[model samples]
Target chain A: MIGFIIERIAFFAAIGGAGYIAFKGFSAIYRNIMLGRKEKLAGNLNTMLLVAFGQKKMFKRPIVAVLHFIFYVAFIVTQIELLEIMIDGAFGTHRFVYHLVEHIAPLRALYVFTVSSIEVLSLMTFFVTIIFFIRRDMLKIPRLSSIDLEGWPNMDAHLILLMEINLILNIFLMNTADMAVSNGAYGLWLSGIFASAFAGWDVEILHILEKVGWWGHLAGVLGFLMYLSISKHLHILLAFPNTYFTRQTPNGYLDNMESVTREVKLMMDPNAAVPESTEDGPVKFGAKDVTDLSWKNLLDAYTCTECGRCTAQCPANLTGKKLSPRTIMMKTRDRLEEVGKNIDANGGIWKDDGKSLIENGYISVEELRACTTCNACVEECPVNISPLNIIMQLRRNLIMEDSNSPAEWNGMFANLENNAAPWQFSQQDRFNWAKEQ
Target chain B: MQVKEMAEYAASGETPEILFWVGCSGSFDQRAQKITRSFVKILNHLNIKFAVLGKEEACTGDPAKRAGNEFVYQMLALQNIEILNGYGVKKIVTTCPHCFNILKNEYPALGGNYEVIHHSTFLQQLINEGKVTMAEGGLFKGKTITYHDSCYLGRANEIYEAPRKVLEQLDAELVEMKSCKTRGLCCGAGGAQMFKEEEHGRIRINEERTQEALNTNATIVAAACPFCNTMITDGVKGKDKQASIKVFDIAELLAAGQGLENIVL
Candidate 1:
């Protein structure tokens, strides 16, 4: 009875502890996002379903899509067993779900089928995770091994795969050990094949192994949950929310600056009444720091999976330019994380770090200048993150705040202001094409 | 071919079916002017009435907006919107993808909404309606032609099929480059690159695109955007393959198909 009481206490304590950490972790991310400028965004159910759930955009590469789908679907389906695990853990019972359904033949069959499928799916997950590892490490699939993921990001990918393997191994050991001790009570098919090997083992040893397996599986899951807050694996939790709030504007449509419009409206109509200058007047034109970016942009930075698909398709990057869309998100996330830590250290007050996102060893003006704004990166991103939008914002600051622009662009601006076009041609001669003919 | 200004249409109390937005390049660039003349010839041949914004037209502010100057962009955008709204322009067509994109997607938010269509889609519609009948064994009947997707007309707007279907009317074997449609490479001229030198890189984007076009073994390349045409032409010349390969706009191809090549500017 004491052992039973201790088991229940341990299970509940761990569960409560993991839940608290998750809450705290997610709240910190929310706080970081709140530090950014506000921009209205509405949730989209259809996009959420098609993009996040259906994994529609991923199908552009069939093989990678299939491999990733196994991980996704298996992750969801395997969670069903967590329900039984919790029940068994709380009650100090073995195979609590099997015992409940054993009385009904149909229910028994359904239970067996569900557990057996999870085992089979686990086997597949184990193999695919290995394959994904090989592709990343051995094959050096260009995007996975790109320079953008040289440090902790690379380790994060490998760590998640190893954790998945550990999780699967524990599930197999626990299920097989249970199958042996219960004498085929659960009727698991895949793990049952290895059940006989454990039949001759001491009954007590089998029970201990089963307990260890159960504890290991639970701890692995909790470990994964806690680690998600700091890993790229957070995409599994955030992709849904990210896709739900994705920008719905057309790819070609850039919202005109309302501040600029106000001035231009008055400039066009000199007789109009002058509006009051905003108390929070424009600060440096565009984004030089992460805080200058929109809250959604910071959300986009946190939600990035670092897949490098956007960079692979970028025209400038393909031609050996410095721009990489994946790095832009990574840098933004790193800076935001730094800001979050700084706030934590300073009693919830922010102090300037003397560092900014642009030209601060995070992103370079040369990289920004290389972008073609072709929307290829925007289209290639499976989660619909627009690195181009961030680039444009930084470019705005470079030109408006620092008066830093290429000579050619400055000339074009001058011509646009004078002749109503990008060239030196007089606006009066615009109809020369028709009159010449 | 007689092209009327919107003012002339208004003076005669006449309204045309479309306002042909001759972008700055179409008016000034020597090479782009040919494309403008070819499109006008087709409209004249079909007896479809169209008017231009003439001198009252200004830049759509696409390059300035892309170059990160919002003030200059909005200054031009407001002025253009005022003129367009004053003319009560309802439908617009342009050969330049940049102009078409800005007008169709960006203008509505600033109160300058109109039925803006790229000439590729416009031509596709005309051909689909059987109004653009091609002569038998047309100029490109036996030639192997590949279509290059302009970024503004393609991923930016998702109008991939219109240009391809228009090329189908040429009765030629339409080949596709390795990178076409959504994956189609840029001609290194987007985002105001046409108005400035390219940022330093190992290879120019247009050169890479030209090599893809050459790999397809297509004698003629069809493009929708004037900027793409210019960049690809320069790329082919850089490789000294200009003698064997020709870059023509869909409008020029259609004009040649209808025996309207004599309409020269």
Candidate 2:
């Protein structure tokens, strides 16, 4: 009775600690995302289904896609079993589903089917995680090992893979020991193979081993849940909502600035009402930092899987330019995190610092200028993230607000302003080529 | 030049079937003027009534928008929208993909809406409706002609089939570069890159794209966009293969195949 009370106390303590940490981390992220400007979201259902659930864009790489699909499906399905584990841990019960299985005939069959499937999936998950480890650590695939992924990003990937391997192993070990103790036919296929190794062992020793496996598996999962908020693995939870709010506009289309459009309309129609100017409230053009960007862009930064698919498919990156689309997303998230920390330290207010995302060297002018606006990065993102939009927004701040653009671009801007074309020719001479024909 | 202005057509109480949007390149660049003339020749041969904005046509401000000068883009766009709206123009066709993209995709957001068509798609439609005809055993017949997909036309607007369909109508064998249609590489000239020196890189994007075209070994490389034409032409010259590989716009090819080359001049 004392041992049972100690087990329950330990389980509740673990649950409370992990829950507190996970909640605080998620709330911080939520606060950071709210700092961005408002944007209306539409077509959420289709985008979520096609991109997050269907994994449509990921299939561009067939072999990796199949392996990832198996792992993704297994991860979601295993949560059902995790729920049962939670119930068992709380009640000090073993195999909570056994009670239901004994009462309903179909429930027994369903319980057996689920356990058998998870046994196979657990093995598949182990194998896939091993391959991921090999790909990242051994092969050092360029996308996986790019300079941007050097410190924590690299270690985070390895830790997740290692943890996954450990978690699956413990789960399997627990099931094998359970089947050996119960001498049950359910979950006997794969577990039976391992159960034979323990046939000569005492049943009391097997029960202790099963308890160790059970406690360790639960602890690992709780730790993983808390770690997710800081890890790139946040995509596991954020990808669905991120894809749902993705921009549905045609990739080639650019949004017109309402402020600029109002000026243009005033120019076109002199009779248009000129609204009175109110007290100044940050009348800057385009994005200078995370605060000026749309909330969807902030969501995009958090949802990035650090997959480097965008960087790999970027024409500018492929041509040896300094622009890595992956880096753009990473830098945006980093700046947002810094700003979040600043607001947290202060009394929920932002104090102007002497530094900013551009001038402080988070993203350089060379990186911004190197982009060709090819939309290739946007196209290749599995979750519909648009690093091109972020790059363009930064470029707008560089040009419109700072008047800091490349000399050639300044000349082009002048030509467009004066001659109504990109060339030095006068607008009157626009049709001269047609006259020659 | 026999191009009539919208004002001229309106004074006579006449409404043309379409407005020919002579973009900056089509109106100013010497080489692109030939593409403009070839397209006009096809329209004339089919008796499709069309008028141009002529000297009144301003740039579509696509370069300004792409180069991050939204102020100048809005200025130019608002002016052109006023001119177009004043004429009550309904349909527009252009040989330049840049203009087609801006006019069709960007203009509506600024309250300038109209039916805009790229000349390649327009020519394909003309042929489909039996308004234009191709002659048997034309100059391009039996030749392997590969089509270079312009970035604005291919990926920007999803117009892969229209140009390919037009090329198919010609007796020439239509070949494809490894990166064609939706997967097409840029000719290193979109996003206003044509006006500026390329950023420092290991290789020019057009040179790489050209190498893909050369690998196909097609005798004639057909392009639709004026910017793409210039880039591929320069790329062919860069490779010193201009003597063997010729670059022609789809409209120019159609004009030649339809025995309307004389009308192009």
Assign candidate 1 its CAPRI class.
Answer: medium
Evaluate candidate 1 by giving its C-alpha RMSD to the native, one decimal.
1.8
Q: What is the C-alpha RMSD of each candidate to the true structure, in Å?
A: 1.8, 2.2
Model 1's DockQ?
0.78
Stretches of model 1 off by over 4 angstroms after superposition: A273-284, B262-265
Q: Which ten residues in a row have the lowest lDDT in candidate 2 chain A?
A: A274-283
- DockQ (0 to 1) for model 2: 0.67
What DockQ class does candidate 2 belong to? medium
Q: Residue-wise lDDT of candidate 1 within B1-265, one digit each (tens)?
A: 5889999999999989999999988988888988999999999989999999989889999998887888888889889888888889999999999999999998887778999999999999899899999888867767899999998988899999999988888889999999888899999898888887877889999999999999999999899998999999999999999878899999998888888874221
Off by over 4 Å in 2: A267-271, A274-280, B262-265
lDDT of 2 by residue, B1-265 (tens): 4677888998999999899998999888888989988888888877778999987888999988887888899889988998999999999999998899999999998879999999989988887988777778867666898999887777677788999888887888888888766567778887778888878888887888889889998988899999989988899899999877888899998888888774221
Error of 1 at A418 (Å): 0.8
